[model samples]
Target: MAGGGRLLRKAFPEHWSFLLGEIALYSLVLLILTGVWLTFFFAPEMSEVVYQGRYVPLRGIRMSRAFDSTLHISFDVRGGLLVRQMHHWAALVFVAAIGVHMLRIFFTGAFRRPRELNWVIGVTLLVIAMSEGFAGYSLPDDLLSGTGLRIAQGIMLSLPVVGTYVSMFVFGAQFPGEDIVPRLYAMHILLLPGLLIALVTVHLMLVFQLKHTQWRGPGRSNRNVVGKPLFPQFMASSTGLSFMVFGVTALLGGLAQINPVWVYGPYRPDEVSTGSQPDWYVGFLEGALRLVPPWETNVAGHTLMWNVLLPAVVLPGLLFTVLYVYPFAEQRLTGEWGGEQHLCDRPRDRPVRTGLGVAGTVFYAVLLLAGGNDIMAYSFRISLNALTWIFRIALVVAPVVAFLITRWLCRALAEAEQKRLTRGQESGEVRQTVEGGYASDHRPVTRFRPGAPRRPIGPGEHTGTASQEPSAPTRRRR
Candidate 1:
């Protein structure tokens, strides 16, 4: 409690949107706890073994030790399945929360100026988290996971000259090599997690050192922050949030089913379950892979598989590169490098940025949906080839349409706000005017703020020089 000149005295914004990062932090904590529990029972090996434990069906079925250990954890160990499910759910939530948090930051222009490096860190964190998730997903060595790894290997081999060497080095053999699972297990448990923890620690330190950005409103400016201090106010709220996250994950782990590796059985190179899908974070890439036309190039007696490399490699590369360069590009465009920004810009006020964000979101959504095209085609009895073509067309067209519509909507909203400042809001009461014309009364638009004093509207904020409606009485506040 004693925080004289300590981080305990730091203030945080009271906005609900600000809690997104906290959700991510808490989810990561749960992931670490549950993952550690899982590590004890999990065997990261590729050795062939007969599954003799648990249910009778899988007994004597030849499987990898990795898959065998997973079955052991699921059925042999006490509460191991629950812990595994919790770890899986926590990873999903961790990635999801970070994504939504980044969206909030992007839409609010919080990535500008002094916070640019933090934004880059955020992008890096998201990339690493996805990588960690993929590595973990592949460690089970189940049929579904092995299929994903097979696809991964295919993607790797789609590279240029070094593709063959890289693929061999990674798998340590042709395909489904002995060392893949162990290597992934090491990276998942040790390397990626350590990096995640270190990066998270640095992110929090930077957040405190840089101070929080607030909205543009009365008495809130770049020069000052308005919110509760960390010690008793923000700390209490954050602590409550962390507990809530843990409880929800625990409940989901206990109640809902996820990653049923037992039903999937062990890895078989020739077998694949139809309607199988990767986790949501990897769905976009899957969609991209499906949407790209099969195209290859002959280069110096070697083949460049554009069908595989373009969507799998180049798309992701360009996406992350754009994210890393966006803040700097915007700064250069607006000449905002002259001074640091501590106030977040309203999305409507920056139509181009808001539009770009919405467009990108739309693009991702389309790709994500495209990832399940086969499932959708069967569900609706549509032709698979037609559906694939439709998704490919939508992928190109949807983002452009979204950008235009969002830009127009932002401009319209900005204009409406300007109108409200001038003519204010309609009172809805029609009355006879002095010249025998009926008119509705207008009142100054007052924003609602619970538990805070109302901001007095300045006269200069409105000039009803061209208004046709009569002035209405000020409404009493609750």
Candidate 2:
């Protein structure tokens, strides 16, 4: 206990960006709690049942037992609805926080050296959590989820020779089979979550082992980290943040009505709700599918639907593969093969890396926008075809433009910072030069060295050095 207590007293860096990871971790905890509560009431069965619940719209309607049980949980079981909604909302927040945290790590170059494995673990956790959320939502057997599942099956079935077999293996027979809900239930509550929890544990352990990477600021450096101890201050703040996450999730669960399965009704093969959409995390894939033009060719007695296979299967695989290999790729490209980095780089300091990050973000944003093209068209009263064409063009053009612009912007910002360091701020005072020309005074800037003490150690004492004059005079000649 004493040894553990000593370990608990270790220091943690004070940075707002670091909180993004904490948010993701706390949301995962909430998800587990709410999901466990929901599991007690949720039925993972596909037996046909006539709905006999308080939701009048679907009352007496014949639907899968899964839907009926979900309605039961919503209207019959006490506090079940709140817990269910909270679980869903937490899932959304979990993935989103992970994404933001990843961006923070990426831009700061926290994924360098020994910490690269942790990055891999973090990305794996994200993928698992996303899959788990999909499974959880689909267990309700609602129209929207069913549609997503069908689309998934279609994507699988588009995979050349083994497509049919893979689809059958996954569904346990055909589309809307009896075994799928139970299988997804097991995956959602057990398999995928277990994998996520394990990966998260490993990731956290790595973080603890490697300590934390901090920005280049006061009292921060590669050799030493600055901030509060974990035992009291960090622990208290983390606990408070966890509670806040729970409270906010609870609040949103009560107020925000998402995935109202009752309104969408039961899953039917032929009937689909107009403007059907998956959750935001899954939007990119939907957008890709929408963007890809239908192109099919027969070869070797198999119909290869390039559009479906390319966007849905090949694209995601390539994206994740690249993501998995990026740390090494970056290390190789920059020839920065070295030891661990405790101090993070400012995004502007690494223009190419920053530009690449911006380009990827733009690509994702474009696809996400493409996913909602129908809604945009309806909202603005524009032609759907025109909107589709616009997105298709934007999808390719935006990322390239963003890359070039971001690279230039990063370089420009770096130049500005250099100027600020060298020339300092303008004093707004005009002086008559010896050459009879007016010139604005530019004072030299004095910045304290990183890790330098900010306050005096003794009473009635002061610290820091005075600003020095610039190396070269700035007097303009007439």
Candidate 3:
């Protein structure tokens, strides 16, 4: 116990950006707590039953026992609605936090060298988390989830050769088969969450081993880290963050309604609610499907439905492939392949990488916007076809524009920093010499100290020493 307590002495950096990862971890805890509560009441059975619950609209309808039990939990069980909504909101926050955290890692080059495997694991966690959320909601057998399931089925069926067989195996028989709810229940509650926990453990182990990459600053060096100890400072900060996450999620659960499956009625293959959409995490895929032009090809004796194959299959594969290989790719391109990184890069200092990150963000943003095109068109009374065409064009153009602008901006900022170092800051006061020449007063801006000469450090160099004051030059007198 003494030794275990001593483990709490581990150092944790006190940076604001570092907290994003903490938010994701806290949200996962909330998700588990709320999910456990929900599990006590949620029935994943698909047996047919007449809904006699308090929800009037669904009251006389024949629905799956899973959905009926959901209505029961929502309307009849005390605090069930709160727990359910909190679970959903936490899931959203979890995914969003992971995304922002990854962006932080990317821009700061925290994914370099020893940390690359952790980056890969984080990406895997994201993918699993998404799958978990999908499975969790689908267990309720609600209309929206049913629709999503159908779309997923369609996407699966578009795969070459074994599409039909795979879909059949997944559904246990066919579309709307009786076995899917339980299967998804096992996966959502057991398989995926278990994998997530394991991966998170491994990720933290790696983090502990490698330590954190920190911003370049005074008294900090690649060989040493400076921060508060984990036992008191980090523990308190992390506890506060966890409580804040819980409070926000609980407030959202009570005040804001989400995934109102009751409003959408039970699952029906013959019926689908209009303006239906997927969760935000999956929106990009939907957007891709919507934006891809319906094109197919026939080669020899085979048919390729390019429409479904490209956006639904090829795009995601390519995206993940690129993501998995990015660190090595960037290392090779930049020829910075042989070192351990313990300091984070300022985004402006790495112009090409920063630009690439921004370009990817813009591309994703366009896809997310395209996901809501239907709602947008309806809200503004615009033509849907016209809006789709516009998004298609924007998807192609926006990333290129963003990349060029971002690269230029990074270069400009780097140049400005250089000028600031060389010329110093203007005091904005005019001074007149005895010769009647006017000059602006300025203050020297060395990185470490005021009177020291500014010397450029070599790339990836850290000497762990303070700047020396410039020696006074010898003067000649007449």
Candidate 4:
């Protein structure tokens, strides 16, 4: 059994590219362990209860059991606050690692052929992770989370026909309702988690079956992997990372307090904070909302849900869908089919693919910045409408420019490579030759033909049949 375990461990790849997925897996494990601990004390119910927790400052306040329990965990339960904070922090890390990992795959052109479906699955996992975080954050029914939900509902209601139905189904009624909290709780704990787990399982299976992409270098074929095994090295590194995550969570819990529902108070209809924001993962959606023009109209007695909802829901859905289908779309465009690629350190090695990835990243960043439009406007003292228009135009124009620039850059590099192959490398300095001509003291150029006569030539010398003497004469002399 020990020998069998050793063999299995030896089969696992230990490349750094493989670590991105491991980081995500470790974060998920931390989330689950912390979540299980918190579940014992948390009350998912939204029924109003008088707050009488261990915190003397906010004693006897009127709040829901969820809020009161949160208070207890924050102040009373042994290391409860730290555990809670760790879970939240780990969640953030999990989402971030997955995003970066997907970017790495995209830039490396690893999302080709056999791994296209895995790419789709990865995008789905991201969507589910975002949903889970949103739901979990909102379960306390705090002012901040409530405001976010309201924005979300508006986005949902912006769809042309089924907006109202979707909104109603999601919220369990309009605005502040009793069922919303419990519904979010169920999704946060059960639905999203299940889906995420299943998708992750499938993703891992695909990864093992297809194998990880190793770095591209001399003698490194795409099928040949290079790295440590999963047993001692990878396992040790992952364990350390898990501990690091826990430590960071604890530090954040002790030093910085986020989502202090006690401070925000209960969810009231009239109250609004100046900078109420959703979690970082969903910030891009918020940015889109700020950038969209507030236009409204009525068609056939049904209100056009454009002003409030379109940016929030439809746009984000479309964006994620595009990400999911991008690999297949790219394959169709390029007509290049392959299995997993060997990893490459230089982004320019695969120019078009890398450029496309960069363009997509820039597009996402633009939207994310747009999400913070109000903050940007306030800081810069610019008209919000003007800011919105600028971003809206950029939303269309920036991506096109990025795509063109990236493609141009790629073509330029390819041209440079061709030139290098034909003309040879240039030395930095020019030297005067003894034969009254300028010469470069650069390394001699080496030609790579499978099997051919090798004769050294000066610059500008003919290298084909003109340069070679008749071999038949030499054979006759021999």
Candidate 4 residue-wise lDDT, 54-128, digit = tens: 766667777777777888887889998888887888889899989999888887777776778899999989988
Model 3 misplaced regions, further than 4 Å = 1-6, 299-302, 433-438, 447-478
Tens-digit per-residue lDDT, 279-345, candidate 2: 8888999999999999999998899999999889998898789889999999998888976677788
Please tell me which predicted candidate would have the highest lDDT against the true structure.
1
> How far in Å is the alpha carbon of 83 misplaced in model 3?
0.4
Q: List per-prediction Cα lDDT, in the order shown.
A: 0.87, 0.83, 0.85, 0.74
Error of 4 at 382 (Å): 3.5
Instruction: Give the Å error, residue 474, model 4.
Output: 46
Model 2 segments more than 4 A misplaced:
449-478
Error of 3 at 453 (Å): 12
Better of 2 and 3 by lDDT: 3
Q: Where is model 4 more than 4 Å wrong at Cα?
A: 1-15, 54-60, 338-346, 414-431, 435-440, 444-478
Error of 3 at 419 (Å): 0.6
